[model samples]
Target: MQDTGSTVPRRQLGRYLLDWRTRAGLTLVTAAELLDISHSSLHRLEHGQTGRIKIGQVEAACELYGVPEELAAAFTGLARQSNGKSWWHEFGDLIPRDFDVYVGLESAAVGIATFQPELIPGLFQTGDYVRALNRAAFPNASEELQDAWVQLKLRRQHRVTRKHRPASVSAVIGEAALRRINGSPKVMAVQLRKLADMSTLPNVELRVLPFRAGFPTGLWVGPCVILDFGITPAGSPVEPPVVFIEGSTVGNLYLEKPHDVERYHRTYDRIRQRSLDAVSSRNLLRQVAKEYLA
Candidate 1:
């Protein structure tokens, strides 16, 4: 079976199906029995692991779960898109095992809030910066493979750059990230300048958490991204917000519970409060870039 490459529609479809099934008070086994499928099959379908979801099955499940007509139609549409390929699928092997899921969510999000303490965020990285990071991470990889990874990074940036409905970005970077040299002084200079340039976009807001901020939360805060899907016409969120915590020694975490999401939001709010404003951040970036050149 061909991998579906972590398509967003499939994940959204699975989440909706799972929520409706639970609301209907049906256990997985019971739901599977009612839907005439094996328990494991239903499990995969609800978790977005099944490849090529059938529209008929989705429609049947929606009816069985007593899903509203409008939502049922939306569910069916998601099923239709479940088999479609995302651009990131081409570089699947080059990315981390679970990172594709993050890419999918990022693609579908209407707004993104990112906090990076140690390095520049991927969406704002320059091509040279990306190549340098990839080379460091995969020193033995071929030049062609590194180039492919750079392309993938550039493609991800389209979320912030596209002319139509560009995703709104609010990013807070620790002073360490600005000072840390990824490839070389020249590379860092260029990267910092690029960051300044990107910050000028109407959809992008950049802030700097200077060293003087002194850990506003009084604890170590790692890198995290909060993704917000836009709401529907009825004023209901299309999907709940998710907090993605990356760079754990174990593995990345995707926090979806309401309380967890709220906690991250509060944490981000506090961090943003301490960070320099957008104008100050832009000035800081240029100053540091000039320092690197000197």
Candidate 2:
């Protein structure tokens, strides 16, 4: 997983600049004037929409905001990192625009909380499961694009599978997801075993929302992945926690607003309370796998 969200560095760098501007109590217009840049340009930079960012621009903005020396250093470093290349560029037209953002965040996140209501979440899905799902969803896609899509997903799994500094992922899967199998019976059987195996990894915690638990009132009724970055040196979040709402028609929606993040967090907590614990969840998965094997 590449740290560059959306195949560029601007998003995270822009976020840092936006934070600095807010901390300096400067509105977009005022900040633009202070930086001697156009208001639109400044806004784009803050939102990470710029494809080309000069290192000096980031440095100047950080200095103007009177950020501490170390924090300014952090900003400059991010600018450099964001400017670098990654594997996402190779896929070209195969990837979705907004989805790139989700991948980038997934790469950088230190803690992840995901709730899957229908199917296995992408990160945990096996290659065969992915092939089946992609084939069904994009029936007209080119062979090259299909292969690229699977590669993209497998690459993204690095967040959880990376041997060193693996991100802590707490996945709450609905029993319906486990039952409504993807791929063939054999493929699904393997996937179930994969889940049972992955759940035992130290950094991955798996729970199951059984059919018996039903649904909660506030649950927005879709799969969502919440990404949380660890704290920075100054005891603030390096990046604010983000909630990714899976979308089919509208692309992926990333919710960074405090309210949206809070709502999802609460819903996840409530649903988690109703779900089976890790041991029981794994047992259920293995039991389900037995049915398929039998």
Candidate 3:
């Protein structure tokens, strides 16, 4: 009995091709020879490990494996999915692999709610702010790598600015974050002024949790993003909202469990309720910026 349990989609696609090849009495080397591709390449195809799978390669692999058109189509779809550029790919090796998944998720998310305590969120940071941050965060990063990371951060910020596909963003920052000077006073002033200007965007809702707001539960958790993947409606596939918590090294914790998602949603609501309104928040941010400017 061919065990099909625990087969991931990519692995299943690979197995489908492999079974076809075996039934056709073709060895891996023989199949590779017939396809005019390398044995190692064929092995990777069989294992579904090809990230940049060429159309010709999928077609050749299917043909050599005697795969049916429909089955071949499925594998081709998988190959295309594998070949799709993940958002983090823009950062190259500068971004750690664990953090890469969050970038990918952020790219696809339609709405975002964030509660940040220590620093500005990535999607809202200016290039100067991001440059300063990247330098501090990755002290060992090369200048070129820092530049690349900053560029990637700027591109991510465009999600809230793009005319057609803007993400609906709501950010609640702690008062301390606004008061803290990230870079030089001049640079910090520029970044804060940008934040003040951004508060007016129709799609953006910026709120600040003032020191007088008393303590809040959300404050204890550090920074987190609650991403809402718009509703699918009845009879459609439902992608539940997810909560992303950044980890220390590079990767982040993706919370998709219903209970965990609900917890963050509730937490965001509590923080929002406890925070100052948009107008007040903008004024507070400006006030802090003024202090830094002086």
Candidate 4:
């Protein structure tokens, strides 16, 4: 998958290379002539438009610019980061690259908040529900891809179960999620039971947004996820908070903008207000499960 998000490092590397070439008194055309590459090809490489960088080309550029060993190594690291096969590639090409970034971030998140309007969140999905959902979402996906998706979904369980700083999760699910039948009655029964079990985990908080709430904050926005990473004091690595919004075919990541983060935080709080308390939400899920038995 090609990562549309998290391109900051890529851009940084591009600027670094461009600056070096300029300091070496080489114009884009001259650099292209010297490297025996087209002007546009050199431009794209310098601008980070090229998704992958050739080690030889990078080394040649470094030599031309007399780049310090340390800086050259750093640039090489950035290129390597962008060149590796996507983590989701194991699921075949069905999962797009944008989603691969989300998977990477989700694995590193120390806390998460999600608003799911129609279906159970992926992290809590049962194997059968996961299989059914993936098939519906990707009708053309191969059986191997579907199986890989299921495996990945189940692997998310470890994030919330690990002993060292388990991820703290708070989810607001629509009541419709519980009322709708995703698969067979047995499948749903087991799914609901799994939800109940997950809810009891110390790090997980579940709330249901009942229809009667009447959109308290007008936060009828589609489902979204907010992930927060553990922050350290000054001198430590800086990992910023990020919000992810998904559409029909792509996903967007909002970071590096304080206003965007603040807006989402307010929106999340408003949505939470419309949701039932944890106890009530669990009761509602239980009632819905009983209805499935009838």
Q: Write the per-residue lDDT of candidate 4 for residues 1-294, one digit (tens) a residue.
A: 654434434544666789899999999999888888888988988776887677677777888889887667666655655564421122334323423445656876788998888999988889999998888889999999999999998998789877888899999998788878887787787888788778888899999888888776754677888877767776552356667775564434335355876788888889888788888888877777777787
Which candidate has the top score in TM-score? Answer: 1
Query: Would you list the rank order by lDDT, best first?
Result: 1, 2, 4, 3
Q: Where in model 1 is the C-alpha error above 4 Å?
A: 1-99
Candidate 2 collision pairs: none
Per-residue lDDT over 195-246 for candidate 3, one digit per residue giving the tens place of the 0 to 100 score: 8899899999999888887677734767999887676767552345777787
Q: Backbone clash tally for model 1?
A: 0
Cα RMSDs, all models: 11.3, 11.3, 10.7, 11.1
> What is the Cα-based lDDT of residue 251 in candidate 2?
56
Q: Is candidate 1 or 2 superior in TM-score?
A: 1
lDDT (tens digit, per residue) of candidate 1 on 22-125:
99999999999999999998888887778888888898999999998766766776676567554222232322343245666787799999999999999999
State the local distance difference test value for candidate 3. Answer: 0.73
Q: Model 1, 92: alpha-carbon shift in Å?
A: 18
The clash number for model 3 is: 1
State TM-scores per candidate.
0.71, 0.69, 0.67, 0.67
Assess the local accuracy of residue 199 in candidate 4 as a C-alpha lDDT between 0 and 100: 83
Clashes of each: 0, 0, 1, 0
